[model samples]
Target: MEPNLILTALFLISAAFTVVTAEYVRPQPRKDLQFPWDPKPSSQPQQVHISLAGDKHMRVTWVTGDRSAPSIVEYGTSSGKYSSVTQGESTSYSYLMYKSGLIHHTIIGPLEHGTVYFYRCGGQGPEFQLKTPAAQFPITFAVAGDLGQTGWTKSTLDHIDRCLYDVHLLPGDLSYADYVQSRWDTFGELVQPLASARPWMVTQGNHEKESIPFFKDGFESYNSRWKMPYEESGSSSNLYYSFEVAGAHIIMLGSYTDYDEDSDQYRWLKADLSKVDRHKTPWLLVLFHVPWYNSNKAHQGEGDSMMAAIEPLLYAASVDIMFAGHVHAYERSKRVNSGKSDTCGAVHITIGDGGNREGLAQRYIHPSPEWSVFREASFGHGELKIVNSTHAFWTWHRNDDDEPVRSDQFWMTSLVSSGCVAERRHELRKILISP
Candidate 1:
């Protein structure tokens, strides 16, 4: 054979060896852990969780069996000492044969940033404590999505609990109740240990749309149960909202909601982006359910329409990162826009593998695309630590690892700080202020 032919043959042999040597971890057994409903005192609070209300307030949400339990929260900086009290409201919904318990939402704060506060809900049950996120940089957000009540979810939550994350950002698909209302209760109970300690900011997913024709509307349970500060951000619907934390302006978009150019979410997003002051909060991040760019064969093209409608606005704002869920795998794209890598574009990350009942999305399109920097099919979560105004770090942690392993990680520089979007910023400002 000629020298060139011999070289080609050697290359083929090496490729074959590499393929054969690649290690594969099969999907774990799917087990949906069930919480038995045992009767407790009517006033005892269960399914407790907390979310950031605004810059200073934290919303404490929980359920009580008593229909008339007071919607009140007593909290203070010291444990078991009630220094302040705030009253919110209570609501309940009925879905088919299921009537929910009295769900209480109480906003208790004007809290001290980075301070631990202990509180009791409905003035009963075990005391829960939460640590407020710092008002500056060096904050951590634990990003996970599609977190159903499964064995894998427990593992993921356990791993997250070990991390000193200031807040938790679930892109969407929280309980995976799939219209089974009881699962939401169990999910809240399962996550209470961690969620009550840190703020869990989330958006909505397709599974949350439990709409019944001519009878019940979608998101009835989700809206009432997980009430975000949509109103605070000038959003009409709870499905989409934005919140600021520790020098990061995090926008949570709704994938299942109306996202057309004229839709409320779009208009709200446009207005919200326009008001973002990069000089104050240098890290601008967005999270939603469906990924705009994915190499996985599953759920391909699902986000194309949404991308077409709103991606330009995101690009114009120079969004530093875009987090998404619902594909049941992990994929990180290079800073990309309209299917091409661009320095000014956002680094899109899909971390839907939060141990949902549905198994991993293992099949991916052959010969990965240019923008997909790293792709894997595994149950895992991601941690994004914004260390300063200009720099941040991201890491993906797989559930199967015996010890915490940074399977994928890299330091990211803010687009604004890097001066990549200076020209676009001027143009965006003109568009925002123009008639």
Candidate 2:
């Protein structure tokens, strides 16, 4: 070795030795920044949430400001202590993830049928848990859409809190993240009261996708700030996924992507519907940010175009009902088959009344459409009550007041028979073919 080279090698080795020794002496933990509201260690858990993956299966998810440690969920009989533990990780292919954000999904299965469970998420020391679930059945869920952080939104959130539903489903368009991060923060604060208590399972909406940083990172603030069952059902992308709660099979779809007949989502959706066993999971519901049968003047006919692409599958597979938020209004359709009233057609509900600056959707976009059952231009959220195999009722809760006016009431008792066909009581599907 040359003398000069030997001298340089010695200096480089010394520098490396110093760095290693310093790091060993005082290694820094991966994260420390905490939400302004959190009182625990800045490194404590956050963005905790849960998703119902099936009748007897529940998925828990949460996030940390720091790179997450091993994710764990401790849960058990609600009101009872969390005695069981479960762990999960994202797949390599799916793990590269939607963007800089890292989302983790953990599925808790073999849950005793019809039982409630309390849970928590995060990592552990001698002990660790992240979220908690209410110890009750017939879980009441507060459903809202297109809610941003305006005065009216605060009013709506406050109103809902007085008599908030069991859980919350802000199907996209949250915080108006499409506008700016400040708005997202304000939006988060508005829902914190309700969200902190129960799971807040969300989907991506057009406005949420409008934020420069949010859209670029696939709603990272939303994705990382809240956990979802994005991977358990093979969605692998929060953009789309499925979960089951009680007698419901909820399929959440992504509308920002191409919904055309020739897209991957179409194929995946076809497969998803095929796999659901009507006997086991019963009620099938689909949710997206855009409507399929909407009749609002602000954004008329936009959703109808999407329906042109996916409605065939929805019809053939017996999708019970569909919910969407976009037009900034509330509308419900009786039932339609081939563009006219049919007893078995899927009921459509539009709940875009979450407090946005635009005010209540007060205009009629369609000129006496056939499927119209009820339409209201009001600022509020929705309450969905799903019971056993035979009954499910929905009510709209005006955010200005806690009163949930029975917006549109229907029965699913003979839904399978009468609801699937005007006259024919069809056999339960084993694998629903997209008829």
Candidate 3:
């Protein structure tokens, strides 16, 4: 064959190979689109959930069709003939396809801990009750993300409801609305059953950053609706915040935000971590949407920059466990630091298997890294039971069957001891004395 003819034949073969590979590598489309469930929101309150406002306060939130309806939460220790009424603000979000109805948030306070209070929102009908957490150690927290409205998601919720956790930590990716605004309402209803009973704390995720052409401010819908304790925690941005439950100091970070050293998040995190008194809250746990130590092939290295920017601070603070959910699978690391297993480092766990529209993350790179202790491709959620200041239990429940089965469970022990804190204090004292 002539040289020109041979070159043309090679080019044609390369082009065909490229086409085949591209087709094989393309991601399959999702089928879980939100059809209209109900055109009109009821006059009565709906989608009621709670958030911990302060040591003596709890915030109740609900939704209603009448935007002009009073955002009043009448509640007291006893049901009927309510003694206190708290007024709150209401807001709604509008999208091209559908606009959300009025969403109300009311903060109720000055109540005794470990006591149940009966409350009714939007004036009357279907009163709900919530018990404030006991001001002590051994509180349970339920965590998961990437949850959408599906049968699998319902199963996950069912399992979660059984756990009877005091608080729910959703590290972003709620609803998975993905520009279809109506899905947010549907998701709100789906989560109301569990969230209404427990304090559902959340952080911003990539999916919540619904950046359209005209409305590019991002997180307007999420920010306007799921108002967390950002203000109370001294965080300037709602995307991130810190709170305490029992003996644990929990820091919720934003993976989609600017996390450079000079960024506001970094500065705030430094301040928050510095102010942590390990003597009070012995276990320091951190949560976000993306994992810094994930071993799965789907979101591998996605959080590398984030890890580089904040890993040092976490290590210095001796964070006990870090939970994240965005990889659509379950992976638990063995106390990792800088992608390597260290005895004193924080245990990183990814529990994104919340049965979203996009299914489990099936593929994983082989010869698992030393840091990765357990990995599972399934729909599930995680429970963290702080048994004491030094010891805690971490369990991941897989929803393969109707009944809850522990895919992975282990005891996580904290390395933060009084001696360590005293030694650091002694070092500071020495520095001050030298100066």
Top candidate (TM-score): 1
lDDT of 3 by residue, 240-353 (tens): 999887888999999999998879998888778767888899988899999898777777789999999888777767788898998888999998787788777788989888
**In model 3, which regions exceed 4 Å deviation?**
1-42, 418-435
The TM-score of predicted model 3 comes to: 0.88
Q: What is the Cα-based lDDT of residue 339 in candidate 2?
A: 73
- The deviation in Å at residue 8 for candidate 3 is 41
Ten-residue stretch with the least lDDT total in model 3: 14-23
The TM-scores, one per candidate, come to: 0.93, 0.73, 0.88
RMSD of 2: 14.8
Q: Which ten residues in a row have the lowest lDDT in candidate 1?
A: 12-21
Candidate 2 — which residues are off by over 4 angstroms? 1-41, 53-57, 66-70, 75-82, 85-140, 158-167, 182-189, 211-221, 400-414, 419-435
Ranking by lDDT: 1, 3, 2
**Superposing every Cα of model 3 onto the true structure, what RMSD results?**
8.8
Q: Give the Cα-based TM-score of candidate 2 against the true structure.
A: 0.73
Write candidate 2's Cα lDDT for 138-238 as tens digits.
55667788887665676567767765355577667776544234344444545644664556777888765532332244555555545566666776576
Q: Write the per-residue lDDT of candidate 1 for residues 106-130, one digit (tens) a residue.
A: 9987999999899999977899999
Better of 1 and 2 by lDDT: 1
* lDDT, candidates in the order shown: 0.88, 0.61, 0.80
Give candidate 1's error at residue 100 in angstroms.
Answer: 0.4
